[model samples]
Target: MEIDWIWGLLGGLLIGSGGAVYLLANGRIMGASGIIGGLVDGSGHATGGERLSFLAGVVTLPFLLTLMFGAVATHITGNLAVLVIAGLLVGIGTRLANGCTSGHGVCGISRLSLRGLVATCIYIAAGVFTVVLFRHLLGIV
Candidate 1:
């Protein structure tokens, strides 16, 4: 396999392991949106300590890695308006769906929840369509 595939596999395994750990330890789904949303909305105040610690780890570990290694280069669109709109749309979608990809795709699907399965399918289809429409049809890529 290619190095990219190897890294992807490792990353996926780590993500799944983290999700499993969160569920087993805290009885919570390891969804980034849910975690952050709860904290933002003050709902996480009930389990403030755990939420805070988890967020801290999420924020700190990445910076620590970058400091130890090097910054992973990324390409983002120069359009700030597009970026802002995209973020807002994603936030709205997550709220409407009552969960994010991590919760639905990883934790929920693992437990054979129909909602998760359906949501994952729908989102995947939407993503594929979006990519095709933009990259192939409009040459946006």
Candidate 2:
């Protein structure tokens, strides 16, 4: 098999395992937005330590890995306004949906939640629509 597939499989397993662990340990869905939002808004005070540790691991693991291995190239938009607006929209959308993809797609769907199923469908549809609009119709990448 290709290295890409191996890495993808490893990454997916790690994500699923992490979500499972968080759910089992804390009885909370492992949503990035909810985790960070709780921390910033003081709503996660009951699990502040766990949340902080999770955030720390998330923030530092890649840097630690880079230090051990090498830096990975990333492509990001050069337009700050566009980046900011996109971030805001994502935040707003997640809030409206009550959970992010990780929460709805992985944990919620695993639990057989109708909301998760609907949200995941909506997210995928919106993503496809956005890609078509931006990349095909508007000639933007």
**Using lDDT as the measure, which candidate wins?**
2
Model 1 C-alpha lDDT per residue in residues 24-63, reported as the tens digit of each score: 9888889887888787788777887887888898889889
lDDT, candidates in the order shown: 0.85, 0.87
Each prediction's TM-score versus the true structure? 0.90, 0.90
Tell me how far the alpha carbon of residue 57 in candidate 2 is from the true structure, in angstroms, after superposition.
0.9
> How does model 1 fare in lDDT?
0.85
What is the per-residue lDDT of model 2 for residues 65-120, given as tens digits with 9 covering 90 to 100?
A: 99999988788878787789889989888877878888888888989999999999
Poorest stretch of ten by lDDT in candidate 1: 73-82
lDDT of 2: 0.87
**Candidate 2: worst 10 consecutive residues by lDDT?**
35-44
Checking candidate 1 for backbone clashes, the offending pairs are none
RMSD of 2: 1.7
